[model samples]
Target: MLTDTRNSRYAKLCGTGGKDVRWTNGFWRDAVASCAKSMVPQLEHMFEAKEISHVVENFRICAGEAEGDFDGTFFGDGDFYKWMESELYSAVLLKDPERFQRLRAYISLIGKAQQPDGYLSTKQIIAAMHGESARNKDINEFEVYNMGHLFTSACLYKRMTGEDSFLDIARKAAGYLANLYDQAEKTGNVQTAVCPSHYMGLIELYRTTGDESYLELAEKSIRLRDSVVDGMDDNQDRIPLKEHKKIIGHAVRATYLYAGVADLYAEKGDPDYLRVLHDVWHNMVSTKMYITGGIGALYNGTSPYGNFFKDQKIHQAFGYEYQLPNVTAYNETCASIGLVMWAYRMFLVEPRAEYMDILERAMLNTNLAAVSLDGKRYFYENMLRRAKKLEYELIWPLTRSEYILSYCCPPNLARVIMESAEYAYAVSEDSVYTGMYGENQAHFHLANGADFVMTQTTDYPYDGNIRLQISDIKKDGPVTLMLRIPGWAERAEVTCHGRTETYGKESAGSYLPVALSSLEDAEIVLSIPMKTRNTIANPMVEEDTAQIAIERGPLVFCMEQPDVETESLDQIWLDPSAEYQLRFEQIDGRRIGVLETTAFQRKIWNGNPETDPEGASNLYRTLPKAEFEPVDARMVPYFAWDNRGVGEMRIWMPYRTR
Candidate 1:
């Protein structure tokens, strides 16, 4: 029995109870504003100006056909329903009340276009009701995929607006899908046909509306997915989540499937689902995931097939691997967005700070980097590092001309940014969890009439000093406020009402709590220690096994070729600790730190007499520990790579040993 009261800790964190925290507030505001200003225009440009109209229009036409008559229809250019769902989520979650009117108009039009028998897909309506031969020819093109996205969009709209009209449409559409897959007596097939994207929508519908039928459908969908799991990985054609355990098939589909499974686990609290989720998560994190938390090993099919790392020839220039060939390494932005979406679902289930940690990293680094700073232009594919000017192409399957047209990333990002508030605050019965640090406030209700307020103040990501103040403690009982010690925090110090207490040890992903009871207007201050440290990646990566990356706090640092102003940045070395100095300076109105260190120049090999194997050459095995003269070097956040016109960037660097 959750009440819409403001005194509860959950309420405060959710912003339902008038509590303000810096991290949650800042992130919510920034995300909302960015999505509105950037994503909206892009989405519109795709529909209004770009070549994606055909695909989008075709999807609408097919949906119309499906709804009009019982017979399915396919208009053209494959199924675009998944893209529509992504757009819907982006619109509903991000725009919310502002976009409500437009959404209502669109939904109303859809309802009006519906059929009499509760079936509501444009494709079916066109083919079955109108008996249009042209539209009915390819009706089965992407039926499951389309149904999945439609379901997702409907659920998202209903949850955000609490409107039942959209829900009605959703119910009708779902009923159609359920009959097609679940109603064996009606469809004359015992087999269940499911699309990965639908699971997210169905699970969400169940969660919000508490529909047991939706849950049952979700379970059936999961079973269907399990049935096809083996087909996805048969040929070693996908990216291995572990050694010889590859996660294969279409990138978007694979992540969506995982997302559906995660949602099912959340709804049913099934231990098997949880175990499978863990298996998938572990596999992805260990191998399939990029440093920025993106997945999708192949660029061509946007598929997660093949061992690209082992076969260097399979690695593509754009981080896109079409059939494991190196010519195209286009890491699709949509795939990245999909990864973020899936990871966010994981966060909801586990409520771990790490999931959000990766989410933040992906958003700041890869997600934001996808589009230009101006927001008008966008890149569907993001390379590991930007090289030459890659033109935007309108190739089908791989490329679409719309900025937001059935092109999933734009709208997906929009929705995520809009609903960013939901991610900030998660509540347990006794305490509220703070995942990311930004400036924001929340309000929620408690069972009791007493009201509570929590406020946070800090400039984080740049600095680690956070101050949280609580006001209006209703009851004289012990209350707990949990502050996540980011995986990057080396040292954490907490001050309760000016009484400073230090937590001796710190780790990357853990939480620190401060207890308060009947204390009004009390403040808690957290000071995080930052220092430069050397780190080595997992030994599995071959070339850089001995190399070290510089890190400070939760950020991983990289050295770019431009920073050294050299054709090859292989000669730089860390000088002695005393000699190297870290300096903060303003670049293009942005404040960034630079680390200066000494390096030995590489000697030319002219068949020299001094070709000593043991002698100290230009290539140093270990970096000097002692102080030396400083050299100019720019340092960027590990997450912010590739945003500033990519050059050769290396997180791990070779250094001369002393």
Candidate 2:
């Protein structure tokens, strides 16, 4: 069994038990409130006593007519339990004690409903006693996705609240699953059945409880996933249980499977699992990923099939080809979150800065970009580009699809935001690793009862300068603090007590540490140099045609409609090394930096031949090149784009040379 009794790098960050950062702190508070508000209305409409009785009786009658029998304790639906578990876990992160208590009560109710032999699926109970013909008649398929959710709930309940009740519930469920799998293995009836979601839950249980049995079960499930891969390789008529060749098969499922594999590797320290992880990671990152760190290339079945990342197509409307047509790329928000989760696990296993780098990119851009400023509504699919009508409709590619019912992104975003505090800090035996920097305060207790405090102050993603102050060091032995310098930082300056000192730079993304003994109130300042940089996309994208995107520190910039002062931004061309002015401005009550450049004059032809040989009929760009006095062109935070009234936005603009 994998033992993580050694304190986590995030011990201090999560130990705060109080709100700190906006995304993690404020979002969690709001999720609890929003979910409570929305769920109350939903429950009122869907589950009043009378409504519950009517639905239950109707369901029972339907079952009896179809199979000539009815069974007691075969409740509402298969997936409802999973949804309930997800909500419970989300509530736990929001620190909703009442909801937590309610979930516990429901767990007890469900526990009591289980049979003597621990065979505890609602659908299975109904089907076994009634008849096999009634299995598909209702919504009672033993869903792997639902079981995964319950496992997540169990793990989260333990992590967030230090409660054991949910863990017990998870153990019972896992035992039931183990029994079924054991029987199948003995009888040679293993029919390629595995759920990726359950791996995360089982790993969490193993981490929290240090249980080997769970780890063993997790190993078996990991092996069973070979079926999914086999199915993909064989190109069977139906969707395979597992998919190889990295063909996309259910965005959420695929990510969960990858995540599960990573977690299992972390627990078992199995080199083979790591090999598989690298294979999947390389395949996905190379072919299946978006520039914004989004996944899910094909819209059909949310599967990763072909070369969908070639051009920028915005297919806002969902159909068979929703994944195709560059315009309508369905980068699911949950998939982005899944990427973060996967990257984070990789970081834990390998401790490479690249994993954390990807994690940061996803968090700052794709993941945070999914939610609106108000935190109420969210986009299920994040589109890189937008059409005028699509923008006005406030329509998102995945949200507009029929597949979503109480869609997963909102709650998924909520959980991520609520649990964001846990992602910042990682710890080894004698040292603490700082992965991402934001404004926050954290306190950590060492195993030997020594306490350390870290206070970070910065306006990050906009600025790369970070100030870290450490306090309350009581030991004579050395304690190392490793601070991550981002891959994008061309130069980094570290100072101790206002005096510059030489600290070694690790390979582009690893942490560089400063050692101090018996230190109290020691200050360290890190300055990350930022400059306007020119970057080339992959050569495979287009030959001799390079796109220009702006970079300052680790943050990437975009050209919004307001910045260009035109309805159609495609007409504008940037001069190479244009002497542009960079400055900060306040937009919609938020401060952001902007870049101003020279505009150009153009001729608008109505598909007719020009009369002049050298010069065409007059047409001027919005800001004529000669008239383009250096002006302050504002840029909101990349995460804050489209929050303003909608217009076309481009992160990569065409640059021309005279």
Candidate 3:
């Protein structure tokens, strides 16, 4: 089970494939295969070297296996844990034997580094080695955030391997949190959460061990927010979560907070919480988010605050309604991934296709785009468009780097990639849901406790045809399967057992139920035409007014300066009557879908309209109409644009209807 939400009342989680499903071939398979060969070793080497990361160094120093002070970033421990999770997932996916040995060593180190009281923040442990008490430490140190990841990774270890060596360490750390929360409840000095992921981690721990006290601790963490003083929008602690409505402030924190609340709500089923989540989600998707499924439009922003508050600036933030900027957009890799996490949780609670749509949108585009096709380099912030000149400066520069100073997004994305199969398909005790189309063989247990072997064959995101065959059915009567017709698909047709059924656009953005009476040796074929179409943004979105974007299948297309034969992007315009061609181009050893079309490039104005003279440049001057020249333009999938070399890139282009 991907999330272990099988017992969750509302969630339709990955009910099948618990370290048993095999990914034969597809985007996710390629990613995991590449991750094992490229990313895992590179990241492992860096994390192990003290001069490079200090992640393992701090743990070793605290465990007395090495000598060093705490030199890692505030979130380095959490990132290390993320890498650990990635390795674990990849190992299981590929059946690599060496990974288990590495995991044993790492687990031993973690258990040794933990203090006897179950306290395990390496920063604090190393500090205590130098006689520095953890008390009075700044909340910004993210000690809770670090230990929270420990709980999740530790639980994953136990769930996947049935081993408690690491889980026991997490139990100790969780025990420390129980006492910490108890004392804070008495003292009223609640530690404010920074980039809070602990909420979901605690809930996962509770789910893994079936412990009610861990669940209580998860709720206590949220209740403690009520006592936080001088809270700001950056951390989402200004008011209690119940009263919070608008989703503003740091994008990563906002999404993580929502996901954690969702985990808590899955068990408790709070209606008010659901309402607030829906409202905020509407605000985000309707106003702030990009069409490519990227979140957090602004690299820096001013959150709502009074004069009494000090420094209300938020980083990697979501700006005001319809304030989406293209060239300077800062859709952090982790922020979009966080959106995916939130969307999955929201889908669990309501079982809506809109949430799943966004989940697929973000996961396939920005989330995959975060790292290179080879899975080595990474982008911290994804921009929709970039040119030689930037009118707005970015705090974190936009470019793919081998390893950034923060080093969070690379491993963060690796874990998502390793776990991509979890999002591919979902199952229940009665039926199976085709959430995403990919080529893989899966084992599922349905009603009557019967296990069946199902194989899905498709080249999705580039093609719309999918085939699913079921065999080895022990017991069956009226087998049912649910199909998720995407919000973007105009219509879909499914043929199974010589029966053909067509669904219109009315069924879009929701699930369609198909009942198969003859269940044994059943074969289902789903065909949805992959038509290339020009899409437009809302009229109120100023950056995209009168502009068009290209989309085919589930992939958004962009025109890189290197791909198109145009002198300038702003002067490049698309013809409504233009015919498009689909071509497969080789990129970084991967075949990518490239769209080729004919367009016009307008020449620069030669003279001022009123003056009738050349070189009379003015910001607001009226200029003579420019001449146009026909140009052959080619567009690549938006995710594959930056991989070709750093240059100008454009997602939206000006278009003329006539």
Candidate 4:
């Protein structure tokens, strides 16, 4: 059995209590509010559309308001539960009394929806009543998936509120699942479930209740991925997980599975699991992921779907190895979140800087890009390139809009951003490692049982300067503070008590550890210079061959039609050796970082009859030097693109050879 203990070599949270952390930076605070503003209306619409009401009505059918059959998909209940989780976070952050009361009311309704046997699925209840054939006993129904979210939300709610009402409901639901699985196992007829998110939820339950059964169930779920009945490769159940080297199938499902695998490794200390995980992570980050930390390259490429079918209509799944297409990329918002989830879990296990680097990359570029600036609009599928007046819609099943039918990404992204405080700082025995940087206040305890409060101030992503102040330190020994030196940062510096330590290339991808004995008015300053530079992709990437993308600090920059005077995106080409000026401009009352540089317009090649002289087209003939005209151009953070109305956007641009 894996032990449930902290990593003695690294910093870990002393307990499951909420870190006394709050964002002091207006940039993040405003972004959080923007996401909340977007989420509240979505929640309201879901409420009005009978999304939440369906769950409430299902409970009433046995007794009160709703009757007959259930509405929406079998997996629809997970959406509502996720929304509730996001709303709960928003309520706490904004201190909105009215929103808090309304969510609590919905919690009560959900509680009333549970059955006597701890069964709490509205779809199943309604299906049984209507005599409709729902998903077979063959692990097809998304019941486990829904219950996983419920368990997670319940755990989060309990941690935040110290209230056990929701936790009690979650415990009951998990008990029912445990009993069902145990009975099936005893009969030698276990159903093979596809989604592994429940594995994560079960782990959370183990963390919450110290129950060995939940951990056992989580391990069983991972092993069950090899079970054959009705499972598909798209769900990542094609083979035993230990043998698979590449991350395949649905991007979100694969990430969720690996996340649970990571959690299990942390608790159980399973070396085989860790070995497989590192292999999968290297395969993903090195080849499958996008420059923007996006995944799920193609919805229906020539990848195996089920046991035997190839490209049998799979959505949001990774495509063949390097088949990345900019315009047709299916980088779903949920997949981006899943990427962060997987990376953060890996960081918890090893406390590596690259893990946090990926986490930050996903948060700033792909995930933040999913939501509009006002937070009212959303993008379900993030495209790397957009054409002008192309009448092109997202090739995925959904269209890009302020609202979506699936409605999963909006709330999910909102909640992830709102809870950014939790990821900023992590602590263990005698140290606190700063995984993410932002203006925030966090209270943490050292492994020696000493408590301290820290305030971090920074304009990160926009500016790389960070200052941390420690107060209220009660300690017997010196505590270590580890600051992550992002992989992209060069010439990073950390100053303490007028003593400065500089990190060169060797220390670029690791943490800078500093030990301090006295905590009376101690301050640490870190500076990572933010300079604009051209980044080139690996030559194996045919789409990006001989192309360059602009990057500054932690953000990947892109060219939007609004920022260029040229008519089309393809007409613009940047000089590889030109100097770039970095500055900020006001957009929607916010300062958006923009990079200005000298570029050229690709002069159209009209038939040069005079040069040809033969009045006939020739395959091999010397032509007049291609005419080029210099032009001034600007680029914005990739996340900030598409905000100034829809227009052409491109990240990889043609480089001028001259």
Among the numbered candidates, top lDDT falls to 3
lDDT tens string, model 3, 426-488? Answer: 766667777656788887776446567788888888888989898877666465788788887
- For candidate 1, the per-residue lDDT at 470 reads 65
Winner by TM-score: 3
Candidate 2 lDDT tens digits, 456-505: 77766556777888765555335677778777766678787668854333
Which tens-of-lDDT digit does each residue in 1-658 have in candidate 1? 1111122121122222112222344423554565566666566545433244443343355444322223212322113333333344445434455456656665676676655555554554556546664421332245445556666666655644567887787778677766655554444433323225667767656655667798788777556432322233322223322233335544565566677766666556667556766775666666555554445545444223434444333221112222221113355666666667677667656767777787776665566556543444455655443222235642422222234333555655555454555555555555667766666654423333334666667655556787776666655335667777777666688888768877755545777777766447677888887767676556664544566667665455677666664444544554324233466654433445555555443332222327734333445555443332335566565444444554566665665545
TM-score of 1: 0.74
Give the candidate order by descending lDDT.
3, 4, 2, 1
lDDT of 1 at 27: 28
Total backbone collisions for each predicted model: 71, 19, 0, 5
Q: Model 4, which residues run further than 4 Å from truth?
A: 1-19, 51-63, 133-140, 187-192, 304-313, 389-399, 474-477, 605-625
Per-residue lDDT tens digits for candidate 4, residues 456-543, read 8888878899999988777544778888988888778899999998888688779998887867678999999887778998777788
Q: Which one wins by lDDT: 1 or 2?
A: 2
lDDT of 4: 0.75
How much lDDT does each candidate structure score?
A: 0.53, 0.55, 0.81, 0.75
In candidate 4, which residue pairs clash?
2-268, 12-427, 12-428, 377-402, 429-447
